[model samples]
Target: MDTHEWQKSSYCQEGEACLHVAAVTTAETVHLTESADPAHSILSTTPAAFGALLRVLRDDDRG
Candidate 1:
């Protein structure tokens, strides 16, 4: 497994339930994981897919 410099989401609070992201540039993958999961089940996807997901989420927030 590739190690990454994970970044906590700005929306995360002071608790275990949190969102984290890491961009693996070398592999062209965007990694996502929740801080609350002890098993650390990672979700890796292409940059384009990640961007699309973010865009959809942003639009949904406004909807």
Candidate 2:
């Protein structure tokens, strides 16, 4: 998928800094970056790895 197609997350408000996530069209990959500094941040990982990261974040937040 074109990196340009990656839109900002709904949770991100126009006046606030946040992150964005997008799915890669050619593979089982996802891309992520900071909305405020797209050029300075990039993360590419498989769906499973991304899911695992989410779980870890959620678990960490609960603790």
Candidate 3:
């Protein structure tokens, strides 16, 4: 697999790591990993699934 350019959220404070996300060039999936332990494991999902997750989180935040 090709190396991906992972990006952390701007909301992350300095020295305080959070989830990092990257797009897979070979597939229509997004890769996710914790910044503090990137070598351990990664979560892969479709863009639609990721969007749904984000939407749910955002809706929950407003309630």
Candidate of highest TM-score: 1
In model 1, what are the clashing residue pairs, if there are any? none
Total backbone collisions for each predicted model:
0, 0, 0
Query: For candidate 2, lDDT tens digit of each residue in 5-63?
Result: 67777678777477778887678888888857746577889999989998998899899
Write down the lDDT that model 2 would get.
0.77
Ranking by lDDT: 1, 3, 2
> Model 1 over residues 1-56: C-alpha lDDT tens digits?
24699999998989889989999898999999998998988998999999999999
The list of candidate 3 runs beyond 4 A from truth reads none
Q: In model 2, which runs have C-alpha deviations exceeding 4 angstroms?
A: 1-7, 10-16, 38-41
Q: Against the unseen true structure, what C-alpha lDDT does each candidate score?
A: 0.91, 0.77, 0.81
Candidate 2: pairs in clash: none
State, as a TM-score between 0 and 1, how close model 3 is to the true structure.
Answer: 0.78
lDDT of 1 at 12: 94
- The order of the candidates by TM-score, greatest first, is 1, 3, 2
TM-score of 2: 0.68
lDDT of 1: 0.91
Go through the candidates in order and give the C-alpha RMSD of each one to the true structure: 1.6, 2.9, 2.4
